[model samples]
Target chain A: MTTSFPMNAGDVPYSYSKNSHLQREVLDGAKEMMKEVIIEHLDIKNMLSSSNKFYIIDLGCSIGPNTFNSMQHVVQVVKDKYHDNILEFQVFFNDHVNNDFNTLFRSLPVDRSYYASGVPGSFHGRLFPSRSIHVAHCSSAIHWLSKTPKELLDEKSSSWNKGLINYIGASNIEVMNAYVAQFEKDMEMFFNARAEEIVPGGMMVLISPQLSEHLLKFFGSSLLDLVNEGKLDESLVNSFNVPVYFPSIEDMTKVVEKNDCFSIERVELTHPKSKLVDEADAKTLMINLRAVLEGLFINHFGSKIAKEAFTRTILKSDEVSAWMKINYKKACQLFIALKRK
Target chain B: MTTSFPMNAGDVPYSYSKNSHLQREVLDGAKEMMKEVIIEHLDIKNMLSSSNKFYIIDLGCSIGPNTFNSMQHVVQVVKDKYHDNILEFQVFFNDHVNNDFNTLFRSLPVDRSYYASGVPGSFHGRLFPSRSIHVAHCSSAIHWLSKTPKELLDEKSSSWNKGLINYIGASNIEVMNAYVAQFEKDMEMFFNARAEEIVPGGMMVLISPQLSEHLLKFFGSSLLDLVNEGKLDESLVNSFNVPVYFPSIEDMTKVVEKNDCFSIERVELTHPKSKLVDEADAKTLMINLRAVLEGLFINHFGSKIAKEAFTRTILKSDEVSAWMKINYKKACQLFIALKRK
Candidate 1:
């Protein structure tokens, strides 16, 4: 694949994180869905008795913007409905050591009126006071391995061989399953931990890059079509490694099913909502491909060379240069807003 | 000082996370107060009824048996109260990208019925769906940054010095303030988003690592005492690098006041429940740190060195090695739950 080594280290699937652009679109879409689910399901009123403290944690709190979104929503519910400080709020923002914490906390608020602290540890393990937390949330970050699932790298096992096979075509089911199994296990640890950490009736919201053939078709078909047209070379397209691992919505559902602590409240699989546009706009809209492209170029040429290549490609591509409008994912989706059992 | 780099990079105060060495004294003692507060101010039943589609996202979810306790409690409550998957639960397992996701997930149930996912992000910003999650629950994951606040690197800051000096001593107040500002912003964003994203009356619960002299006092007169006793080294203690940016509980309440969306439900700083003692052998226990110690040592010593040093350190001192215990910080500790406006 063209994506660089970081792709291997950070690979989950459909890796778009390195994309500096389109973040707004992804962020906006995820936020909107979350608000809808929270409002529809949980009644923040009487529940948020002005007299109780509320807790919320965000796992994989990358750059923490989404964590902020989740907590702000909870605080707003308390203030607007209860209109009192009777309910204390504690929001825990957590992520791996490699995460950009400085960026995460650089602009945090002081005044300590509401409790905020770091729970340093893996979510798979215990990271809380028993039954002390209320709501737990995370988004766009779970597909990563806590470790490399390194054992799976045995390369000797049928699973390993299947995983390592040349990219014959679509997501190799065997490989996908292996990856999904790991994803499932990762989630289990996360939920089980929450099971011990959250209070009854607490909620968990998860917004992730959903797998939709229709949306992916746009990515895949378009890429393949470009390759056929010679606008994109096999090497170039091959170099584009999607950083995301999108288990079928069904598989994702099954992964959740593995945990009894939380039940699935919703499963959404709709094309990501982006502004409508023409082919030209769609090319630029391929902003999520930045990470994909960078990783590719870096692997092919090295950072410096990759940087130059990325610039050249963006600057020269008529495919991207063509249209004058914007187009969002035809079917990127989200789901799994749940409550503690 | 020896704690390691970026104190909040998921390092347990003592060293690492372990379930075997739980000193129930702290949990039990804290529970007494928790029970009273449960009776006096917080009403879990009422809160549960009101909260729906809320999520409890735990930052720094660790591995070990204790991890699932919180979810287990919630499940029991649900079984007793609803006996159905009426609520949604999403367990977000999180930590550094390099954390042990495999191990963390190993302990999680693989039932595929629970809503589960991994959140690869930080808490200092938005990590959940915008305003969508009801409760933001985090236990023992704050106070530590995903890493140290970055401004400390500014040459002009003067707040940062060179060499060993960098490793020891509390981080610059300016850096802390920066983190606080970021944290407050995180909170503000949370509330603001809650106003828009969360349902009215959604709640948040958190169990976090707080910074309070009282908390330190519970173990010793001061951190110095522990150091003097050789329980912790002076340099090692100071070299922790990460700042336990525990904003005062009082300040927390005030900060919430400033927030337009959230109201304070309650904030209590109590010792860890002492009842959480070891019934097996029956003796004083320390913070559960062994299980996680390896990770800590490796984090600081770079694996090979860490492995040797860890072995040497454990073998070298009885005081440091006596199956270390965990004594939680008191003062502005646990927050029962809160509702967002």
Candidate 2:
């Protein structure tokens, strides 16, 4: 589906702005690596477009102070690399059209170095003019597929993910295959769009978090509990599948090879240092997850049922923490840097 | 002052969206003229930069449907002028940082021919990269001075417009001169900034309404009526000078001449055909006026007092209609098209 699924908008208690600390942490952890990647791989002389402007686009930039920080860092690194000060930076903060751009624009740093503009569209398609962008940065956003695969919702299909929210930790191999196929399609679309937008020799840096199978299972169980209690319909659960996919290193490299437009410059997997070690951490994680997924839940099951499901999940934070402690080793954050050929 | 005063936001009863019929009428009148002028003066070969992207910016583009219409018209005109079809259009919708960009983005035409982006900043300064923009359009926005000329706000200045909301009908020559000087300075800043942002052969289209001295007087009388009674403080009225300056044809021509960067291509003044000849029309006019001026009133006086004044104005719609019948001939909309030399 090309339809945009946005995060919670505005700065209410449960808004993405208030609950995006985990995203901030991921971005913070990637900054040094991003800087090094830019320094090592950025061909400043060739990357500058004829307009003498360096166009940097942040795909899937949600409402932020984090997007602002990340974009500013990119500008600074580019500035330091090209000491002549001849190049101007025009940073485009992009997200789904339905995203909270008002908050994002208002929160833009007053003394920002780059000229800021907001591009509202799905990144899976062409968002910018061909060969116009110089650097593309996407963090903690690549995992979201354009939409949940249709097979997961079709009753006739063997891949129907009934009574579950996602393919992660699914008992059905067909369900996993359907999700994997969707992820490959989305990545191909994403890479193809970026290939057209980025100029020759331009760079793209992506920070993607691997799927935490246990967390999805934990959240899925909450909905199943409601199903057992006859509070929610089993059919409703059957129709709802989270549109997220965390790719393995092999999965990503294979896609890049297939696109054949970008040369893979760097591939590294770093596990987040902080884990849900306690109930407090687990509660915070659940809240963050809700902030990101609540819109999807509300869209599918109505707000009342979504609220009940999230409340059930939050109440079982201790179990989530225990599950995380045992499975945290498997969770990984993937960093990939590519140069357009 | 660099502080941005936004138009009424969202689709509420008094929002600018609901109250901008006159603006739409004015724009409708200008579209054919805009097309003719673009056909005659647009140097397509020189306007296209090396990037082959035609950049267009709508300054003071409040939450749009009107701005969208206007920008789309501009893009269409340019496309028709250049038959090669090699150019890409990037349209920037700009307003104050506090503008309701959320509504604007959400309401954007999904099938628009050009890529859309929202730029949040005052247009009085440099907003785009140098020599990047090819066309700049400002409609019903130039009259808003950067701030109420500081002199009008200073109690010690002879130009202090006490007991009046604008210099439009002020009897004091000093008050008029202060407003005149501020307008010239603001126009100079506007032209200089556009000169840097717009390519050498770029075009700027402006639509400004001549100050409605009678309308300002009518609105001022309502506040004065409150002052005559003990309901409002005189000092508050003294501190409130409306920050709008509608320039005469000669006044605007002089500023364009002084800027010396653009060659004036066309100057036309058209009286809006629809007049407030009856109470119904007068009431509609009052609501439209409220949408445009309520933010300024609420900022100066509190919301209660502002509402009270607008109520009093609406209550006297018959008088307003009568007044408009006599003086409607004097009300003129000015259209100016300029091309960078």
Candidate 3:
């Protein structure tokens, strides 16, 4: 279920602070890519002469800590390049309108060199002036579709995502196709909006969760089995579908090629250190998972039952505990950096 | 008596909320001027074609209901012009870095059409990119000098503002000239910075306190006299000088002409409804007056003594009470509209 309600720091403090450790590791990995690709490859002379306002936007800059960390990396790179000019750095932190901007501004790092401003609204459409932004970035975002494909909700349609909250466990091929269709459409809009906002020679780097291209199997699919056995209306799962889609590198690159507004400079898949390795046990994983997916569960089942349901299902599974004990081998993330054509 | 400290909403909430009714009335009076000189005279067709991003800024936008009210007027003017297009209005509320952004954001009106972003900095310098802004508005701010004239503090100089908080009643000719010199420097710098930021055809409207050209005398100069009598040290008054300078229409025009980047479109001097008519009693006026000048008093007399000094001085004056009962006859404000040349 795609939520109109924003995932704000105030509302989902636990999810952002604790459960988002995997996203943080991915951001840490990308800082090297930022230096190697963005700082080295970018036209520094042109940037110095053309303008002093080096505009940088963090697309899904949800809230504090991580957003500040990511912005610091971008600012550090710019400061290294233009240390003499007294460059005015304007960093725009963008998220949905309902996001917790209050907490974000109140907790801003006191030592920030760049001017901080919030750009509220969904990134699936235009949010800035034409040719205003120099660089754009998104981490652990873009996989969430703009909204669920309308076809999946129709009872008469072949792609009806019945009896599942996510397509990861769906047996039907049509259900998978529906999710793919939505991802393609959403990506096209995202690319088109960025093309309009970003200046020529600017760059956009997106980091998102991805499926292993060669692997066919996955772990942790048994928690739903426990849910089906536990108390809840079974048909609620039939109507509920997670809007998040993890695309393969091939699928993402194809969308980038189809858009034709940006030239693909690089694409790579990397495995970030999983939270389950050192920090999370089966019990801890259950709590973290509940923090992340409680929204989805609450949308279908009421909030009163959602926490209890996740607790009952994940706590009873011995396979979940066993799976989490080892460092996860199958999880992957796709990084795509594109230059404006 | 002039303050380096910001008169932020957090620091002077009582004063701004009460004593600032005169400023609000002046802002209300500028609505017609904005329509006539901005919407009617401006090249609206060019603005529509050049970009969908309509950038408006409120320079020295102190926190709260007045900033919101002023912004509402600016937004309304733009909306009336660009009603058909999907205009993305971005309003930057700016003040000194120490200004209360927390209270400002918290008190934003529920129905604002523009996306609100707080820009923290001094407006006497650059705050935005070249050709980035379309229209700018400021109210009751320009009278404030960037800093107090250093000449006033020189003990041997004829310009030394001895035994006074402001140049309004200065006995020495050189003291008045020092204030005028500082005003010219600050205004020139202000114009130069705005010329670099605003688009070629953009407009700037400034509303500020002014001295009536014909007035040879003033009311309420006696309040400071009472303060001089009640204070702990006499030389503190001798060294004190208010940074605020109320320029005549002639003085303002001279600066506007010197900085040729902006052409003067209109200059009007208007009298706002005096506070004596609606909600002010002699005691209330004393509290409000203290609110406005407490920062200055605290700097010279310490916070503990300042409040009690103002209370004791104002409460003892029958002359101050007589002055408050009548509609202020001599108070005047200047409204200037400028077009980027």
- Candidate 2 residues lying further than 4 Å off, grouped into runs, are A211-213, A275-280, B211-213, B272-280
Ranked by lDDT, top first: 2, 3, 1
Candidate 3 is graded, for docking, as incorrect
Q: Which tens-of-lDDT digit does each residue in B1-341 have in candidate 3? A: 22354552553445555455545666776777777787665665674465577888999877756788888888787778657776777788887665666567656676787767777666777777676678899887787788889779778887887666677667888988998998898888888889988878888999885532211122124435545567455566566666778887898899889988888899988765555423434554455455556676678668666666665656644655554447354556788888887
Question: What local distance difference test score does each model get?
Answer: 0.48, 0.85, 0.70
The per-candidate count of clashes, in order, stands at 203, 1, 2
Which scores greater on lDDT, model 2 or model 3? 2
| Candidate 1 structure quality by residue, lDDT tens digits, A167-192 | 12445455455656666776678778
Question: Which candidate order results from sorting by TM-score in descending order?
Answer: 2, 3, 1
Q: Number of clashes in model 1? A: 203
True contacts kept of each: 0.00, 0.69, 0.17
Tens digit of per-residue lDDT, candidate 1, span B1-341: 11223112232444333343342232333334333333344333444564444354555555533445554444344334444435655555544444444344444654422344444434444444444344344455544434444455445565442222122233556544665664565555444544543445655555553323222222222334445566555544334333345655755675577876665666766544334322312222223433434455456435564444334433333443222233222323555444565
TM-score of chain B of each: 0.60, 0.95, 0.87
Candidate 3, A1-341: lDDT as tens digits: 33544442453535555565555667887778777777665665574465576888999887667888989888888778666766767888887765666567656787887777777667887777777788899987787788878777677999987656567767889989999998998888898899988888888889885532111112123335534677555555556666778888888888989989998888888776656444435555455445545666677668766656665655554655555445355556788888887
